[model samples]
Target: MATSRDQTLSIVYSSTATRPLNDADLSALLAISRRNNARAEVTGMLLYRGGRFLQV
Candidate 1:
């Protein structure tokens, strides 16, 4: 897809957490993230692997 100069392109960024999160922490994070994302019209997925998080 092509975008006009006046329009900004949407990009996907991912990051890994510095440490592992417990169940409670993860739940709280998801809850807050969902709320914020919904309000901002943001959509993405999160992956937990080997004590780290990959969010995009």
Candidate 2:
């Protein structure tokens, strides 16, 4: 069994993309999660409202 490097990523997106995220985007996000977890990183959530990004 392969160990999971990427724990998880929870996102609440706003102003949906012209094209919703596909497989590639999902893979990339997973990669980020792994890298973050490895370094004891704090993964932040970005909120887009009125074209502004709010980090929470």
Candidate 3:
């Protein structure tokens, strides 16, 4: 009985960082992202490598 608008959705995003992020920077970014996503009731995974980011 679900319409398109009522269905769960998935997204994939990729980006390149202008500058490399250090451990502390990555940690901080993750903390903030987790907090924001939690507040929005959103869940996904993040991957970073060689100045690139992938979110799903």
Number of the predicted model whose TM-score against the real structure is largest = 3
Q: Candidate 3 on 1-56: residue-level lDDT in tens?
A: 89875778899999999998999999999999999999987889999999999999
Clashes of each: 0, 0, 0
**Ranking of all predicted structures according to lDDT, beginning with the best and ending with the worst:** 3, 1, 2
lDDT per residue as tens, model 1, 1-45: 655644554665556777777889889988999999999767788
Provide the TM-score for each candidate, comma-separated.
Answer: 0.64, 0.37, 0.86
The list of candidate 1 runs beyond 4 A from truth reads 1-14
User: Which candidate has the top score in lDDT?
Assistant: 3
The model with the greater TM-score, 1 or 3, is: 3
Consecutive 10-residue window with the lowest summed lDDT within model 2? 47-56
Clashing pairs in 1: none
Backbone clash pairs in model 1 (N, Cα, C under 3 Å; residues 3+ apart or in different chains), count: 0
**Global CA lDDT computed for model 1:** 0.76
